[model samples]
Target: MKNLLFTVFTVAALFSACTNDADVKTFVNANGYTIYNDSLISFQKMIIEDGKVRQVGGEELSEMGEVIDVQGKTILPGLIDAHAHVMGLGFQELNINVAGIETLEATLDSIKAYAEANPELEWIQGRGWNQTLWPENEFPTAADLDKVVPDRPVWLTRVDGHAGWGNTKAMEMANISQDTPDPQGGKVIRDRTGKATGVFIDAAESYVTQHIPAPTAEERRLALEKALEKMASEGITSVHDAGIPAQTWELYKKFADEGNMITRIYAMIGGTGNDFDELSKNGPIKSYANDRLALRSVKISADGALGSRGAAMKEPYSDDPGNRGLLFYEQDELNEMVDKSVSNGYQTNIHAIGDRANDVVLNAFEQAIDEFGDQGLRHRIEHAQIVSLEDIPRFKELDLIASMQATHATSDMNMAEDRVGSERIKGGYAWQKFLDQGTVIANGSDFPVEHVNPFFGLYSSVTRQDHEGNPPNGWYPEERLSREETLRSFTLDAAFAAHQEDVLGSLEPGKWADFIIIDRDFFEVPAIEIWQTKVLETWVAGDKVYGNSD
Candidate 1:
């Protein structure tokens, strides 16, 4: 009887041990199961539990629970746009959109139609008209616009955002004429007989633009929403919005508070006297509101763009003799703003295109660094195009980010060489040189100036060609970046420039689940095929924000 009791007790103990083991195994598997299987070049499978990744590898995933099969798709971290005029793009869409209008007739017709539809509006506002793409590359005269909207004043911008084309009524309203001296860093295109031609470049645009009415608060909110939706659909999860106004910053906060902000925005308040004084009194915002909106930078325009021949060059343009480009701000004023931004713990992003403008910006940044020491402040030079060879190394020496638009090189390739000449072309868009010197480049599209899609950027960076693949061997092929380097510029390097690398820009574990699934694997496909790739879906923080059925 005692032996029988011993056998029963032993059996009971074994059963208890088995039950405890099963309970422990269930808890671990339920809580600890997070995996990312990247076995295919075009797809990746992520397994998550309680919002964090447990593992990421390229192998079987039979053990993973609730498997997300992202098969036959290329997975990459959600793209970051290092430089963009988001508010400007949004506002332009709400007003008149003449982006693709080819001829002068088409531009006038669009304006006439807009005027008829919005009769209640005080001033007619529009943007996006490029004379460069037209049959006649010369600037349009007021007569072209005057024929359509003789009664209504109209203000239209060139595609480069550096020039404006206004009607006769608008020009008259601004009191602009042949005798009106051109603004320091701008131009008023004139006829052969010295009459104003209605085309104004750079600072000259402000002459007519300042007269246009500002959008209402509600209208501004709607524009911001529209911009965010478009950005998410194109695989952009974050943007460094350049030149945001104080009122716009308030609207951004409201949207963020209501959880309506789809894309993370690092806003650079426009550096005006009032803005600087306000910022100085209150101090920089310094990565606030859960890192969704950071107001820690200021944007200053030191020069204009190359398309309008307004970028400040060291020497006169080879094609346009007796004319050097414009500088938007004086050197002394630029230096003061740089010092103020650095002292107040704000990053300074200055727009510099031509060699002379780039030199001035570099000098200011160097001085600021010397005064403040390196606070890990990643100050930036926006559109570092046409940089001098001597100034290229300054980017690395001062730990500055080159926030460049890859498509700029491809788009400008046809005319850039003529503007700077063959001797100076070597220093133009020198991406490879900056990379070799251990500097990080943040890639962007400068949208409304170029396409918002990142593939255009990727294609241009790797091939140095437009969508159709021009120049056979690629334009300035030496400046072309490797496939991996180009991808990094848009991804990891871009994130680092925004000071948000820890959360986004990579698919590693412990990072936010922000990524995109594309139709083609960039690594395995031909360079030309990259531009043709399509984004299938985009996710932000494990939530699918954009997806296409077809």
Candidate 2:
């Protein structure tokens, strides 16, 4: 009798939902979990029309087209990763990934194996290598790589993508030698005799990359497609593709038109590219395939990564006192860059991982905002990872968003304290402090560097511990964000950072029906178990992108 009754109601709802609107869809009997006004709420039914959320949780909710019984599973706004390299993740799939390899021998063996299998390849290109995990905790030289692949150039980026390791073949091919002076804002990693050691930090990476053979347009397209599919399967509805070159912009447009863009992309123009002039003069491109693609932001790198010891610290590294790390641009240069970007109507996001870099960039933003009269522009500081106590409240004062990666704290737990010393470490990864001052934090995984799972980021943000539950009380436990705050960091807050909150983030009316269903309610789960939560379904624009064939 119960089965018969459900079947009859489903048919009636389906007929009613499918009335005038061909695209109208109704989801009923859902947990319909969502965050509104900083609190979690649940709705039992929702109506989607014209790819927008038409109504949410009303007893009189009229079904429009097709009706789906979510079976009371936990539903949430589709996850959006505020920081990631989408194209690079796809290429990582195509190349060698030595991400979690712990030992130097394992890394060399993997490179050798990859080269042996792909004899047709011109060069060996891959990422995710951290020398700090090695016994010596020192940078590897070309000689180390030459021991594995002397015949061809091997270029592997450090896990953070801020530094790179190359073999002798790569340096030689690029004409790097003892005479090659270090590029400004970059390091050549020279020996005592001043010979180039095939390790490039920050801006210096361009030297070898410029020499590398570019991926063919088809190869890039394939990579983008792979990334899009992977994101959908992972229950990600939107990805902020960190810094994309001009060539990729054309491909993004093509994919959006053809409806291959299962996941929406909010991109930032690469500052190093020459296409800035054309893009800046034309201002932002806000309406691409009804916001499936958006490019209104410019990405600027103020410094390098913490792991590489290339994040310009206010004081010299505790472990390596001689090194204070690299700063990409002087304040004057940064001020000019911010001025140009904001004046032409672009939101500027600078990568600042260290206290020194954050302070410098903040100063630059302050001066630029003053000069440009930025009206409600949410300029951003990406990876506002390590900051000083005095400069903490300035984020709120300046109305700047702290774009952070939650998993970074867990990943760097062991080394972060030793590198910065206990005093400075207090203000590092200070999520709670930022929140107390009413500063918005947009959280994500710097994927392909950390794991791509959004759950991992949420777990780290809420628990401040690694997967094993280390650091008894959590590393800087007071700095951890509550579960409520962390969810906002990933959802509504992330959308706000990309200037898409009105349509993309929440599961409320007038927003795109982009949401996911999970096996368990994140709020109901034990904090330690959050990372293990599985996504059952992902829907975008009222269409199921992953899971549930019906």
Q: Which candidate is the best by TM-score?
A: 2
**Candidate 1, 1-550: lDDT as tens digits:** 1111111000011111222221121111110111123111221244333333333443333323444555445667778888988887777768898876768678778888999899987778878887766678678888988888888788888877899888889988989877977888888888898888898888778888887777788888888988888888888888888887778888889988988877888888788468766655677775655566888889999998888899999999998997779987778888898988888888889999999999999999988888889898799999999998988998988889999999889888878998999988888999998999998899998887877788889999999987777888899898899776787788778878877877667655566666777787676678899988887787776667899837
lDDT of candidate 2 over 1-550, digit per residue (tens): 1111111111123223346566877787776666665556667778888787777764466755778878878788999899999998989878889897888889999999999999988899999998878787788889999999999999999999988999999988888977777787888888898888778998889989999999998899888888888888788899887888888888999999999889999999888347777555677987689889999999999998888888999889998889999998888988888888888888889999999999999998899878878677799999998999999988988999999999999999879998999999988999989989999899888888888889999999988998888887889899898777887889999999999988878877678999998888777777889999888888899888889534
Per-candidate Cα lDDT values, in order, are 0.77, 0.85
Worst 10 residues of 1 by lDDT: 3-12
The alpha-carbon deviation from the true structure for residue 165 of candidate 1, after best TM-score superposition, in angstroms, is: 0.9
**Model 2 lDDT vs. the true structure?**
0.85
How many collisions between residues are there in candidate 1? 1
What are the TM-scores, per candidate, against the unseen true structure?
0.89, 0.94
